[model samples]
Target: MLVDSYGRRIRKLRVSLTDQCNLRCHYCMPINAEFMEVNRYLTPKEYGEIIAELVTLGLEEVRLTGGEPLLRQALPEILTTISRCSLKKISLTTNGILLHRYLELLQQHHILDLNISLDSLKPEIFTQITHGRNLSQIQTNITLAKQQGFRIKINTVMMRGVNDLELFNFVEYAKSENIEIRFLELMRIGQACQQQQDQFIPAQELIDRLKTRYTLQAQAMPLDSTAFNFITECGARIGFIASESQPFCGHCSRWRLSADGILRACLLKTDGLEIRELNHEQRLAAYEQLLGMKPYLRPMEVTHLMHQIGG
Candidate 1:
């Protein structure tokens, strides 16, 4: 295993395939955010080479993330290429707008695990949060994905007063759909900083609410996992990523790679080692530098936004 100086074995890598997306989510991307040029990001072959190397270095899971991974034109090809890597698990984190367009391609590539962003179930509120008009389409595609044997995991960023009222609604939806749902605490980074202070909601609040009505059985999850998993009374699996109220940095065993090849040791940190132009030996040295600099815990303040850091 690739153990850092801090003794955290780095086994999972979150690779941002593209820093572009179709929707302008309020908490993730800024309304006027400038995206990286397409050519500036690594190509599929380059990603394959790097990922293959990482896999050999004890990387067990690869999760392709993006501003919206599905928006990348070469997504199918990219998935197909990365599928060649000797990794235990492969997944994608997407906004789910273009999921239907890539459903067949995904199945062809055998990429099944999906962590989809769905902040709201109400049409108007969904539009308000995502600045997109495809809530119904997203819902349809989610259903389709489930029908096609994909393990669906819905990720909801809970903002106070914005969609906190829909907490029970989301729980009910997850229960009815028989899908795992995780409520994420709104981190004070990037576009989220521009949001009103009242908009921020702690994961503890939701945990308290859920506990009031149901029995929450604490369950074990993967290492460096951000979420605290629980099995609810209604058989719906639920989780909370309380990064703000209760930091889980001590157990963090993963790292993030941006589209342009910046290696972020921690999401709360802005400065990172850029490995886009590095050679093999140089890249390995840079990785060591990042691991050496990895903090034991995140600081009180965070300035980088979700999209900028690769959510």
Candidate 2:
């Protein structure tokens, strides 16, 4: 098992398929973001082999992420490779622009748990935030996925004076759809650092605002869960990924693998260990070294963009 100095065993792995995305969310990357060359990313077979190796080392769950995972052309092949592993669960995080196109393929591989990023319910606001014009389509896809029995979670980056006004709207949607909605506080990483001071919203502030209209009962979750979940009186499930307001580094059992094969133990760390060419034994050794490097406390900031590190 890959255990850190703090005794936190790594059980979850997030693999970034590529650093290319269709939408340009300001907090994640610049509108004119320069992406890495396609040739630099680990091939589908390489990703599969790395994930298979990690599974043997106690990685139970794998979450495929990216600048936008759906944008990767080799996704089907990658999924086919990973489906051959002995993982307990395989989930996906996407912007949902092209999700409708791959629903069938995802289901074929048993990847039903999905975390879809949706910052605004209003089309104009969504376009304003993401520089994309497909809010209606994304909403339709969300509904379609739900109807198809996919466990869906809506991930929203809660920013002050930006989308904070729509907090109750998100709660209502969650209640009506009977889905989980997670509000993430903006982090001071990459391009987001410029606006973090002005846009960051505390999870407690949101909870206080929510308490005025709904009674939220704290829900018990696994120790390794990044989100602190709660259920409303109206049967709505909500969660707060309070990275800034309330850090959860103590029980963090997750690590990330960038599309180009760098292993990161913490989101806020600037450095990572590259393991692209490592054999099984060499990769195992690299995993141990990375685990030892895991920080006991969350760092104040990071130089890397969310896309670069596989958010």
Candidate 3:
């Protein structure tokens, strides 16, 4: 097991299957940059092996992320492998474009936690922010996912001038559908890094605005959600990821694995130990090195694309 400077045991692992994504969001990229090439990605087998080892090292929760995980053909295979492992929970954080196509396989594997990236309820705004994605398809997929009886979450990146007004609209929409909505304070990274200082709005303001129309409050963890700890006065709840506003670095029980096999101490850390370069024996030694790493500092921000980190 690996313990950081704060004595937090790293257990949650976010595994990036590939840096390639089908949609291009401005916050995630410039909306015209290229995706990771095929050869640069990790194969299903290699990733599974890493997770199997990671589980042995006290990793209990695993999230399958990608620019779009479903874009990869062997995605279901990877899901099944992770589900079969001793990890307590296995979930997927996706853009939801390809979810409807494989909802059954997901349910069959008992991988129910699904987080979808949806910034706007309006189609035009969706297209503008995500470059070329169709808003109608995402809406339809969200509806279908709920009807299918899967635990679903809508992850919204709260941009100041961009989608701030949509906040209340988004909450009303989630409340109507009875789905958990998370208002995330956008993290500045990569091409979106510069915009962080300009675009980021603290979660406190979002809750203040929502309180005008609703009597909601931030809920505690484990009971509310591992991802979102909340309970609403209206009998519904919303999640606010205050990564920048109120850093959870102390209790941050998570780590990220780049698609190419880099074990990042934190997304903001410019450097990481590359486990993929080592042999089997060396890989075990590498895991030990991870035990010596410091707690992820909040100001130490991620430099790569969100897709590259498996957003």
lDDT of 2 at 23: 90
Q: What's model 2's TM-score? A: 0.98
State the TM-score for model 3.
0.93
Between candidates 2 and 3, name the one with more favorable TM-score: 2
For each candidate in turn, the TM-score is 0.96, 0.98, 0.93
Residue pair clashes in candidate 2:
none
Per-residue lDDT of model 1, residues 1-311, tens digit only? 46887789888888898888888888887778888888888788878878887888889998889888888888767887899998898899998988988888888877899999999999999999988899999999999999999999999999887899999899989999999999988887877877747787887778889888889999988777888899987898898888888898887878898888888888888889988788899988887788877789787667776876688
Residues 1-311, model 2: lDDT tens digits:
88877889999999899999999999999988889999999998998898888888899999999989998999999999999989999999998888899999999999999999999998888998999999988888999999999999999998888899999999999878878999999999998999999999999999999999999999999988999999988899999999987999999999999999999998889788999988888988898889888898889998788899898
User: Could you give candidate 3's per-residue lDDT for residues 265-292 as a string of tens digits?
Assistant: 6666666788876777898887777756
Clashes of each: 2, 0, 2
Q: Note each model's CA RMSD in angstroms.
A: 1.4, 0.8, 2.0
Using TM-score as the measure, the top candidate is: 2
Candidates sorted by TM-score, best first: 2, 1, 3
- Choose 2 or 3, whichever is better by lDDT: 2
Q: What's the lDDT of the predicted structure labeled candidate 3? A: 0.79
For model 3, name the residue pairs that clash.
268-301, 268-302
- Badly placed stretches (over 4 Å) of model 1 are none
Model 3 residue 244 distance off true place after TM-score fit, in angstroms: 0.8
